[model samples]
Target: MSALLRKIMNFGPAFFAIGYTIGTGSVTSMIVAGSTYGMQLLWVLFLSCLFSGALIYAYGNFAIVTGQTALYSFKKHLRFGKPIALMIIVGVTFGQWNSLIGILGISSNIIFEMISLYVPSAAEHKYEIVLAIAVVIIGTMYSILLIGKYSLFEKILVMFVSCMGISFVLSLLVVHPMPAEVAAGFIPKIPEIAGGKMMVAAFVGTTMAAATFLSRPLFIQGKGWTMKNRAQQRKDAIVAAVLVFVISGSVMAVAHGALYHEGKRITHVLDMVNALEPIAGKAALTVFFFGTLAAGLSSVFPCMLIAPLLIEDYRSGQLDTNSKQFRIITGFAALLALAIPIFGFNPVKGQILTQVFNVFVLPLVIVGILFIINNRKLMKDYAAGKTLNIILGFALLFAIAISVNGVIALAGQF
Candidate 1:
């Protein structure tokens, strides 16, 4: 490839990473975090984004250097026996299953809300039809991936991210949050609650899945990055991290200003969009819907693709794009994505569950990545620096605390 083309290709993995983060679950999670806690949990978002980015960089660099995906590297280089690898595989697979369900559920809800605007008569019983539509859309996404072209998917994801970014930023502008309050949100402070414990748990759970840090290495590997191109990979990872932070922060700012300030509560993405309609007018509402739709669809593509790759890697030691197991797992995931809407589960609840699952899974994945990236045999000169290790170690601890608290909160709700 020419120099210019190669430079552009370096962006490929970042776009893929964005898709992993910006999906249906992500948008809904951000909305929940913003509406429920206002800017109180904004620090978690920053911490999650920074920590995840660091891990992504480490694992991406590892993959590029060693020419192996994170999972494969873990199996080959880690002292842990096959049992540990099996456990990781099983855990990751289950996590993906929950993620798929949640993504499908939220995406279906978005579609249902968007369509309900046109046909108010069907608003009450449209969920079944919405689920069917979601399935068809997921199938279309799968067909696009079956062709095995990253550029096409990357371009589409970039476009979606752009639209979503513009919509949320515009919404934030319309709402115009108090600069002081917004600034305060950036400060690390826990929210005040009667007991403080539940509030802390919700705060942690809500921000836990800021993005899928574990999947970044696999994405980087798929892009064919190598150690010789470590600089390029670092650039790509940085780009992705910044995008995630900006987009998520924009959503929170808009919600904090538009919804929380007005004492408005949002249980769905449409609620967030509808809240903007009065202030920003119908055009703004339309933009919000379009942005959200794009976010949902862009996420569907990666969830369908990467979840299956993780599953297949767990079963076999390699990612054979052509293998029957790979195709079957992808097909199954796509089907589940479609089925989520059909079941008529509350999208908000499903999104919360997804975040909670990520909270639980994140610590394990972080520990694994930290271990592998720091392994002398695997990283050699590139082993995680002391500062990075300390940061990651604290991040893992935070994730564990959040995961436990989230589970307790969920149990309380039940």
Candidate 2:
């Protein structure tokens, strides 16, 4: 039992990567994509994960080689390094905090929905109920942040990711997509439908999240790994990317099977539950919300940390979670996230802005690591080889193409 437990725990950093990437943003985007286009965008999801694996390995290897975090390495090594690193720090931090607002709002709404399932009249007190629930949830996550230990973070994320992945996989089983349609999704063709372009960009934007790659080094450092653990790090990246594909695909599959076939559309995240109850029974509702909660909390924990993590990474190669900066930043993020639920603002709008902004930074992030990893001085003898370079070159082109079209699609909405 102990040996088996150790094996699960060994994928600690992978869980951190997976936990943060496969959150509310990914779930909402997948639901919309699945319901709207019925698995046509699986190609985008697949490519995102494929490149994400390459970027993860690149960023992580750079950190291991330099014995420094990502932003710091860029600051010290590249031309205009300081400004570039600072831009990433600002861009990624802003995007993550914005994501927190949406994550908290969705999580609390789901809780209220679950409560109302039993106490139907709970709908009458929706505002106060959601606010109170948000407080409790945010407070618990803040308390976890205050604990300030990487092991604690890793363990909690493991539980959340496991719960979320298992629950979603079970839900997919309850309402699986057609096997041929699932296979066809991988053949690379976008539907010529109205929202196809936007959903494609969103799938890429959310799954290939900037926070995921930017934050990888810190998580890797937290685990005390270095170049000697190269093999393990490679294994971990693969594990993380594969899990993102499986879990996110399961979500898309569920929406496709449960809602698409019935010609139902889910406009809001809560609509997922409303749409499910009639077809899949209350048991499925409980499981889906449970997974959503896990996804939300897992994401919220990382969003709260990203600000401090990036700032510390920029200031120095080392992380000081016990520092005053960590406390102040995380506290501010928690309170700001609660505001979305408290004021009843549209988190979807904020998330849309965040997603679009992320696409812009995606190319920059890929460019930075590409230059940094191939530098012999910084990497000494272990600069990246030709094969990895080819993969990143393609990833960069993909990011730029997505960025151009994503902005246009988003602009077209208004």
Candidate 3:
């Protein structure tokens, strides 16, 4: 194989990170932010990606140096380790599974919208049709999990992620937003409008995702990285963080160009498609929805894998694809994910709300990693240096601050 191909293959962890991080939740939050607040929240996206990169480096480094999974290390090495690890598993699983509900729901709704566009009469029996579509999506995604190895399965998700990134990038090029306003968005002020604080929280929630970092060690382990591949892991983390910012930023830009300037907001999933139509032309619906669907599916698969993946991490560092615990837990997750689609509610609000809720659980994730990565015995020379320590400190503080805002925003909504 060529050197380029080899380099690409080595960035497996980063590819999975892009596929996980830029999924439906991030896409949805970006769309909402851009269409609703124009470019004002790019600061949140920028900071999240920066911190996410640092945390990914920290977690992947600890895993490679110590040769163990995160929860397993937590259980074995800390005071009250078992309970703490179990609580993380529970907290992360709850946030992730709740995300799946919105993910599957949004995916089903988008699919149904696409079908209705081409086959106008299909809207008559929306419930039955959407329910069937949701089941098929769940089944196909779950079956993909049984594909035997992490490497092979992640490759399939790479296709979905590719489609997602390309569509938005192309749209942004076609109907670009103003560079001045886009530049202004990075100045770091949250909008004072209703849900503005919550939108900031959701943006952080999706970009600096808890699952993305919490599961980083397992993903690194699955990719077979060890101490020898330290440089490769850092480069891969950078690759993942850059792709996340670029793709997600493209989505936000496309939405701002198409909708925000016109004072239209994305109240529905298809509103994005409709907004893009006038600016990017008739292909807008097909192109943007294709990207959105890919984004949604990208997140769905990861959500299915996380609970079981973390559970196994807590039990032992080893991940057996064939284990009964993996199968049973994932199957239950896929089944429960159907609730949103079956109930037939519009999921955009729920999706954003879930993303905001994810913010509250993030501080604990960083706290756990902080303890382990700083342990001199466990990390040795790989222990976080001053730079990484400072980044993680800000990351923890950022998580806590947004989480408080998320709670306030959530309370007002109620």
Best by TM-score: 2
Error of 2 at 101 (Å): 0.3
Candidate 3 runs further than 4 Å off: 1-6
- Give the candidate order by descending TM-score: 2, 3, 1
Report the C-alpha lDDT of model 2 over 1-414, residue by residue, as the tens digit.
Answer: 889879989889899888778888788888877887898889899999999999988888877878877888888888998988888888888778878888998889889889988899999999999999999999999988898999999999998999999999999989889999999999888789877777778778788888888888988889999778888989999999999999999999999998888888866656887888987899887998899889988998888999889888888778777888799889999899987887887655455555666677888899889999999988888899999999999999999999888888888889
Worst 10 residues of 1 by lDDT: 202-211
- Model 1 accuracy (lDDT, Cα): 0.67
lDDT of each: 0.67, 0.86, 0.85
- Superposition TM-score, candidate 3 onto the true structure: 0.96
Candidate 3: C-alpha RMSD after superposition: 1.6
The segments of candidate 2 whose C-alpha lies over 4 angstroms from its true place after superposition are 346-353
Question: Model 1, 1-414: lDDT tens per residue?
Answer: 478755655588777677777766666666665666677767777887777677668767777766666665656666773555566666555655666777777666667766776677777777667767777787787787676665577777767776777777776667656777767777877666432344455334433442355456666656666667799888887887788788877777766776776777776656765776787676666666676677777677666666566655555434456666667778888877765576666776666565565566577667777888777786788888888899889888888877777777667766
What total of clashing residue pairs does each candidate reach?
1, 0, 0
Q: Which TM-score value belongs to model 2?
A: 0.97
* Angstrom error at residue 158, model 2: 0.5
lDDT of 3 by residue, 1-414 (tens): 478766677788887777668777778888888888998998889999999999888889998898888889889988888988888888778888888998888889889888887898998998899899999999998887876589777777777887888888877878668889989998989898888988998898888888888788888888887778999999999989999999999988887877887989887776865677666776766788888899888888788888888888888777787788888888999999999877767788888888887777688788888999999998887778888898999999999999998888888887
Name the better of 2 and 3 by lDDT: 2
RMSD of 2: 1.3
Flag clash pairs in model 3.
none
